[model samples]
Target: MGGLSPAKRLYQTIIHQYSRTINCNSSNHLAQRLIQEPISRIKTTLDSETVNKSGDENLEFSWDSLLTCVHHHSPPKAQLVLEWRLEKLLKEKEKNENLYSDLIHLCGKIHDPQTAMRVFTSMESNHGGKPSSNVLDALISAHLSSNNMVTALSIFETMQNSDDYKPTAHTYNLFISAFANLGNSKAMLAWYSAKIASGFLADLDAYGALILGSVKLKRFEDAEKFYGEMLEARIKPNAVVLHSMLVGFCEQKDLVKIRGFLKGVLEHKWRIDGYMAEKLIGFYCELKLVEEMEWVLVALTETNHNQDLDTVSQIHNGLIRFYAKLDRLDDMEYSVGRMLKQGASFRSHKDVENVLCSYFRAGAYDRLDVFLEFIKDSHELARSSYELLVAGYRRAGLCEKVDLVIKDLETQRKE
Candidate 1:
């Protein structure tokens, strides 16, 4: 009777152990078993079976099947399987470049630099294969993943010295991102400068990282320079890049720059998401620039057709509050109406009070009555409106209207 093939035997062993652990209701134990047992035993069992059956030194273990079997496990365990398989393959004198790359990447994923370097060395010494760019990337990424910038940079420098391996854009981006993560703008800029000197045009991602790193280091001038370079390179700035610039401008209170950038953004038809729009509006509001605020709000609302209800509400709320502050009652009323039309509610009593005061000061009693009627069902807003009206009536010695507002307030409270 023929026993199961080595691959099938490994699969059945995994399944039986998994089922056994599951039946015992110990999922953690099952996980431990999955991670610890199968790959460890697979090599020994297959080796013994192969020797006993066919006296064939080459084991028929399937790398694809092994990878598939361990695909669902955590990176560490998957890495373990790959390591075991690689060790066995090396013993069998099998030289697979792809397998070497796969194991290096697996080690990188787990940030296992020690193991990754071992795999790199083994690929050279044991398999007699020159390290490809893919393997080098994996090794560098492993160091980056571990946040070991020194070692990563060392490896990168080694790659630069290699006659055969030229670092890709991805390699430079990883270095840039790693420096940015460290908040070392100088180091990041150095990398960018090196990349430019290498005749590599900075991609949008690289530009963005430099812009953001400059902003982080409070080098707003450098950030602007990078942004200008990006534009000159004809790489269109996305919302993220533009927003970072906007925030940097706002931080410096450079309204002139902000207005210019916003004009270009609007003219270019860049997709302005709600958060960025809201931030720009907030800046305009803080600067007390009503026209700019209104223009940005209208442009963003028109452009962002997919704006969610909450974002719309926030937009209207900002407009209403700003208009109320400027005593622009008509604009406030328009914003409120727009908000209502968009299925958003105004809940700011302070804004409602300001609107009522504006209406009273302007002697728009008829409009006030209509506005009151519109918000009559809103208990808190109506109460605030009535109180403001009552206060105004009392100050003007209109005792009759004061009594009337007080009576309406009492009636609403009762209801």
Candidate 2:
């Protein structure tokens, strides 16, 4: 035994390590002493009738102990013991009633999905026992977790057709959701549509998935169509569906349609809030559609006249900024005046600067004069406001007028 090769010595070291934990400890430097015997000797001892005598009580502890060794040892070192012990328990046991659920669950915990599938398949073939929903669900989820959608779909298709395996909406929804997660939105939509045509109405979750996917793909038309079909099928839209539609419309900058849809929600006595209105207003303003932005703001005030002040300010600031960006001096002035009339006077420095810049750039000398008269008479000049007027005079070929402003500033400072 001492004359054995180091490779054989390493194998013996592993077996002895496990034996120390499971059985009586002997300083059996079984390392060199046991090296001459075949590795199958240890494998056989693990799977022998002696261990099967206690049935699942002992099988559980044995398998659990064997698994720890299998994980700790390299594949070449533990392969014989792992395969032999698994085969022995599977073949020799009549049925493990108490361990069935646990074993089924264990199949999912195993890293190699193919091995888990083989174990489950073997259990079906030898025991002729039907797998439970929990077991099947675990198997489907396992395959999905591995991104093996083809195998997972095959299992789902079989389950749907089986008399014993009743497919619930959750089952279909889950399969659809897995495909959706893969960004196979078209396939996800087709599957549910096919199921519905076959007279199987998947739950709202399935439709919700389609809506979200369609929105993500920027297919607002498809999303809206699918939404209508859901409603027509008598599947009420949940908050997610409603929110998805709102966000989809917002992305498309369809403020008009969003307003109409939101109004419909309100007419049904659904709650409307300032945040939703802000989203609508912000979308239109981003598109620089001043008219549509105003329409949404008016609708908001009409729907909830006591709208939050902060929301009102956000909407007004957005409108001013939009017109100013386009250099629509008249439009910008009108929007600011309307906001002031609405008693919204906490002006944004940015909004004021934008208006001045637009006015200066527009080169409307008469309009610049009106602004100057307003500033002088009002006796209110933000530091930048005067700078804009000086720039405005220079651009209008009134350099003398600009110099006059500088002279006035010097006199005021001296005084």
Tens digits of per-residue lDDT for model 2 on 1-415?
Answer: 5985443333243234323432301112222222333665755444342344445323434444344344344333344433453476577774653344344334333433455455555555445555555555655665665676666666666565555655555666767767767778778877787667767766788888888778877788888998888878878777777878889988876657877887776555454455565666667766667777777667655665445656666777778778878888877777776776765643445566676777777766677566556545324455566676687788788988789777876676676
RMSD of 1: 14.0
Q: Which ranges of candidate 2 are over 4 A from the true structure?
A: 1-148, 154-165, 180-186, 197-202, 215-221, 233-240, 243-259, 269-283, 305-313, 327-415
TM-score of 1: 0.55
lDDT of 2 at 311: 65
- Per-residue lDDT of model 1, residues 1-415, tens digit only: 1575433332233234323432312333333445556655744543453353457654334444444444556555566655675687688676777777777766666566667766766665455545666677777777787886666766676567666667777788778877877789878978887887888888998988888887877889999998998888889997668878988999999878887887677677665567676796678887787777767667656765545556556667778888777778778888878777757777567767877777777777778878878866642655666777888888777898889889878887888
**What local lDDT score does residue 273 receive in model 1, on the 0 to 100 scale?**
62
* Residue pairs with backbone atoms closer than 3 Å in model 1 (clashes): none
- Model 2: weakest 10-residue lDDT segment is 24-33
| Candidate 2 Cα RMSD (Å) | 18.4
TM-score leader? 1
lDDT of each: 0.70, 0.61
